[model samples]
Target chain A: MIKRKRRIETFSFFDHTGICKHLEKMAVKGWMIERLTNFGWIYRRIEPKNIKFEISYYPKASEFDPEPSDDQKTFHEFCAHTGWKLACTCAQLQIFYNELENPIPIETEPTLEVQTIHASAKKSFIPAYILLLILSVLQCFFLVSGLLGDPIDTLSNTAKLFSTVCFFILLIICTVELCCYFSWYGKAKRRQSKVSFINRQAHLFYRKLSLLL
Target chain B: MPRAKFQTLTEQMFYILLCLKDECYGLDILDKVPSMTAGRVNVGSGTLYNLLEQFLDAQIIRETKVEGRRRTYILTEKGKDMLKKEYERINAQVTDYKNIFEKEEIV
Candidate 1:
């Protein structure tokens, strides 16, 4: 019997709540998340049981770190005191699980939680997504200019047409992601209840789009 | 406008500072707050960890001892003063309530 499985789950970087719910669902089916890797999320087969999951972001953490830093270790120790065991970490994202039924949560202050998430996003995804948005916009502009400058040459080149389409798709994705993040950030700042801003339609659309790409 | 830094302590922050009154291992506060509040209030481990870091940065709490991963902390003078101020603020609210409602009862 296969004891391990790996699958790519494209959750937004800031969707820790969504990720926790998904992981909890996976645990009920007998697969426990072992670690997150460049390949995908690896799950180890376990006895089918219910477990609670929580995720937190540490902005100072980096993927390049050889091992957990002293501060991260201390944070984990504190969580462990409340029965939260560290499950895995992917860069700044930390996943923890608690077998106890009524364990106190790891994050109680919503404002602080949002700030930490925003800081982590800035450190990683925010900049990368912004750069991708810029590159896609430039590519689309050049493609359009070429089309206008020489319609025949631009239309006849299959590679050019394909690249143009890809750049357009990239542009759309980048724009949607940035807009969604900023909107969520704005709402979260006003009220922490808005922290769990899961755009299911957009998420589904992205999943289908990724499969196509 | 953004909230002023630590101007008013939230419930969790108040309890955290209350726990720090006695030098105790950082993790011990996890159990202390809930017990102190009769399980009415609970501090999440992540919340405690982050608050401790912020308090240290603000010089509200000072690390007293470290034994490998286990470290102890105590409220600094600044922290104590802040806690006292919060206590007085809450007391004033209660006093105001009594002044209005209790006087009506006597009348």
Candidate 2:
């Protein structure tokens, strides 16, 4: 018989250390992360064991790619030769595990690791936030114009009222997400010292939401 | 862009470039670094892998050959110059360590 559990995975893009520590704890409890789902991570029961986890950002990798590209394959092979076994991957984040005692950590050069993370985020959240900002701005422009042009009719009509409420919700969400991204980025840029992200509480909220689902 | 800052590379970066001074496969570096440093320094695979990519991008190293799953790399001219500068910088630091043995010496 196989026992399994689903838990929301909390990984603030900058808090790689936190996620790795979380996984290490899970391993201590005999739960190994089996797969990533839309909501969170699903774990399968296993023998309680100590394992070292490492994460790397592969900017060139795509989740949609049918097969590992030649460069990625070669890179993995090199890591394998060094005793780190590939565990799982989500999008561009590659995770590896090692059962060996006190293995050397994957990220050695602190400044380079920080630089690589910034480069990856440039390709990801920066564009996402910008697009969201543009969309919400357009949404606000239309809704505000309509309200001002004909105050009585705009407030009287249910359709316009519904859209006004929807746009406001979107605006709030976009603003919050942008703030969260930049705040974390700024703190993470300092590097070296272990940094905790402010979005941890927000992530815990999502984890609870995922648990219900 | 301060030339002096970059002219001095981290221990791992210095050793990685030194390892590629001889044409060798990527995997070979995994073992070579520890052995050369007499176990004092260890370069993790992920660290080494990413460093190799950065080196390739910066033209510090070039892929010499690919044999099946293993790819060999060698230092380029730019890499050699950088490595030489780093070597000289470290030597200069040791040469300047005249006050550590004498407490009376002041900056």
Candidate 3:
């Protein structure tokens, strides 16, 4: 009988302790774990058979100054050793690995600006709609108060009645606008969360699948 | 303290306890295991976190310290006992399997 040994691949990344927390969370579901030391800094890996892999984490980069500290140089060397492609002078590090079962080349496009605009529009709409609703209520109050009073003269009284009726009509229009805003706001938020969750799950699945292949 | 022993634990929970046998943070354990096993297992952040909460609840592991907002974990006495018993059980199973195979060859 021929016994087949499973082929395992290894990938490493240098990142902060937080990334470790993310992996440890996954390890509880039966993924194997190991820590490796190259130099003084530690590297980590998560091995799951028959899974695609992805590793994403931030790494510490040193400050740029006239005179650099030894600590800064050391940090750069550590980041280089840990397979960090990009370095930022940030405290937290994130590293992630996904098994490449279905290897799809990532396409880079300018999306941040578009996303920012959409986010701002959504945020602006929420408050504007709320304000409109409030104004509508206030207008109704003025109209009600005016109707309860007798103006000093017939002309003034007639004018007050006309103004009160106009306010009521405007209030109805604003109320409708507020309702539309709320529906739009709720749908946008729900869709955003759903899309985010699905994207995460897909990334995870691909990462795991990469390991298997 | 004697490590708390469990009659059974899910494979992930056992591996987590085993991973914490030494000083480790979340990412360290994540990277260590996959390479050690040659990528035979990978744990994702969501699953790893939920299990950590369970182990903390079970008193198997405790957060030792925070380094710049990251929590490091060390096994508690009860956790050690649980790991020890698990190791013993696995060793026994391996031995039993080896003996069975050897006897079958002789026959």
Candidate 4:
């Protein structure tokens, strides 16, 4: 019998609420989140139970850390005191689980939570998006210039046209993601709102489909 | 843009400052809050951790001791001042409620 499972579900880095909800649903099916990896989210089979999942961000955490830093350990200790135990961590994102019924939430202050999310997002999400956006723009510019320079050659080659379409889709995705982040950050300051960068499942599916094409 | 840094304190923040009035361990705030409020208020550990950092940045709280990861903190004068202001603001709301409702009772 299989004891572990891995699934690729695209949950945006900022979408902790969404991730937590999904994990809870998984927990009820006797599979608990064990780790997050480049390949997928790993789950280990467990006795079916209702458990709560929480995500917290530590902007200073890095993937290169050999172990939890002193401050991170301290933070974990505090959470443990209230029934929230460390489940796993991926870079700045720490996932915690509590078996206690109605455990106190890991984040009580919405404003502070939003600030932490933004700080974490700036560390990873923003830079990646910026790099992807630059890449897409450069590729688009080169393709357009090539078409203008030699319309017959560019149009006739199926590969160039496909590359152009893929890069155009990438550019749109990057632009929308960056714009959504900024807009959400701006509104988050004025009022409390759930942190989300839009569901990326469909976007990811399209990207994969484009890659295959 | 982010509320001018500690202009108002949330209930959790208020309780955290109350816990730090005397030198206290950072993790102790997690338990102290709920008991102090008779379990009416609880500070999430993550919230407490981040708030401590933010309070330190704003000079509202200062580290008193560090026994490895078990650090101690105490509310600074600024933190005390903010707590007092929040107390007064809450008090004023209660006073307004009594002023209106008490008069209505007489009528």
Best candidate, lDDT: 1
lDDT per residue as tens, model 1, B1-107: 55677999989999999999999888999999989999999998888998999999999999999998889999999999999999999999999999999999999
lDDT per residue (tens digit) for residues A1-213 in model 2: 669998765565545666778889999999888777677788889899999887777777767878778888777777777677777777667778888898777767666666666677677756777787788788778877977898788778888678666766666655765676667666666554325545566766754444343
Candidate 2 chain A: 10-residue stretch with minimal lDDT:
A204-213
**Native-contact fraction for each model?**
0.74, 0.61, 0.00, 0.83
Docking class of 4: medium
Q: Candidate 3 overall Cα lDDT vs. reference?
A: 0.46
Question: lDDT at B104 for candidate 2?
Answer: 48
Which residue pairs clash in candidate 1? none
Q: Chain A alone, TM-score for each of the models?
A: 0.93, 0.77, 0.29, 0.87
What are the lDDT figures for the candidates, one per model?
0.89, 0.76, 0.46, 0.86
Evaluated on chain A only, model 1 obtains a TM-score of 0.93
Give candidate 2's iRMS in Å, 1 decimal. 3.0
Model 3, A1-213: lDDT tens digits are 222122232221221222344444544443533322232233233343443222222112222234434533433333333333221222222233334454321101112112322343344433555676677678667656654663345236666567656656556555544453344444435443211112234434543454343
| Residues A103-191 of candidate 4: C-alpha lDDT, one tens digit per residue | 99989888888889889888988998999999989988988898789989888999978887888888877887678678778777776
Better candidate number, 2 or 3, judged by lDDT: 2
